[model samples]
Target: MVSRQAGLLLAALVALAGVSVVGGEVVDAPPTLTVENDGDTTYRVTAYTVESVEDALLTNFRVTTPAGENRLVTYSQLVWPAGYRNVTVTDSVPSQQVTVPPNEAVETEIRVWEPGDVTIYIIEEPDDETHVWSDMKACTERQQEHSIRLRDGYEGGGSTCASDLDLLFR
Candidate 1:
């Protein structure tokens, strides 16, 4: 009887693991990273994943250069909770600012100059005064990594870049 009970408990756990509901959408619950090529030959990336109740949302992103130094990137907005905004970029190569919405899914770009396999990170704190660190409930429970590229386009002797951002839902 003990063995049978253990089997039933394990089956229940497995069933729970397979169930996922985000924003009322039936999902498999995999962590995902999104990348976009914005106008002006810049790239924008936003990482979204599941989070524990204890985590906060004042997050940041980082891109590492071939030189081994990390360049902090900025965002124009946050998608969750609906109206948080960003004002400046710190430790970022091409400094920029953004306006974030609260608790919703968003992918706004702040800066991008080159193209390569980039490692994007979601930081736990805001970089400057204008931007508040992601709140504790805004944190992700599982960790994920992603790579993005920014391409340059030229038309009529002028340069025009566009963002073809990709959204991943897991």
Candidate 2:
């Protein structure tokens, strides 16, 4: 029932108060980890390092490709169309420690020639290590928070740290 002049005055007052009353979709930030393809050849899980990201946060990323060739990739930025196998940590890797200054990661790689499975494990028990863990937290989709702790060993579903990181990403 407001007149045009009154509505304009109200909008001006709202703008002066720095309030936005517009109805619009609220976008969420993308996760640090996502499944992506490397060039035209392979897929990779890239951990995006942003300013809000705390350094030395344990993200025990593991990829166990039983059949195809796999590796720790740093440079590929292409977002592979949402199709991935969700590989795990397996086999053995003869990898040189390559640091991508932007990604801030240390990784392992392995390839299996024979048909049998290759079991690979990475970054174990952050608590047992000399590295200091920050008070990073994990939160569920419901927005409940939990403490981030690395287990003595990776108990299968995912590495403890990776699982917690997944939680935080939600």
Candidate 3:
């Protein structure tokens, strides 16, 4: 039979080993970007902002590659709010466009080696007739306040109605 003192010593050693093992590795929190649709209609997300550590502003929708380098590639797609779709964006990588349904939310996991900021842009579709709720400025203001709404149409003569949501990474 094992003595009480021996058992206690073994337990303490195991605990110390566990701590040392964990201390030897560097762990970082996973970065995530989420967009929630609290409006009544669905909106298509066309672009998002990626601010690099060097303060370079980049857009995920349209990226121009450097000379002699591969074209900046961006994958855009649609996603349902409550589904098992696995969407991940690596560090310095652009995520695919995701259409967020009404009353639902979509998120992308961003893996960055350095700290930066991410801004999501929601472009409102143009309508034949002007709409009260389709104002891009209003929509942007609402988004900044964390209140998401449907962007059916814009009153102005612009081709697209775009809004942005900024997020920071440490």
Per-model clash counts, in order, read: 35, 6, 6
Give the per-residue lDDT digits (tens) of candidate 1, residues 72-145. Answer: 54332332212233322343333222322222233333232112212223221133222222211122222222
In candidate 2, what residue range of length 10 has the lowest lDDT sum? 75-84
Q: Per-residue lDDT for 1-170 in model 2, tens only?
A: 56988988866754554334556422222222211112222112212222222211322323323343343321111112111133222223322111222223223322211112112222211222211111221221221212111222211222222232343343
**Model 1 alpha-carbon miss at residue 142, Å:** 2.9
Q: Scored by Cα lDDT, where does model 1 land?
A: 0.30
lDDT of 2: 0.25
lDDT of each: 0.30, 0.25, 0.35
In order of lDDT, best first, we have: 3, 1, 2
The TM-score of candidate 1 is 0.23
Q: Candidate 3's residue-wise lDDT over 40-62, tens digit each?
A: 66655433334532222222222
Clashing pairs in 2: 63-88, 64-88, 90-120, 91-118, 91-119, 91-120
Better of 2 and 3 by lDDT: 3
lDDT value, residue 115 of candidate 1? 29
TM-score of each predicted structure versus truth: 0.23, 0.17, 0.33
RMSD in Å for model 1: 16.0
Q: Every model's Cα RMSD, please?
A: 16.0, 17.4, 14.7
- Sorted by TM-score (best first), the order is 3, 1, 2
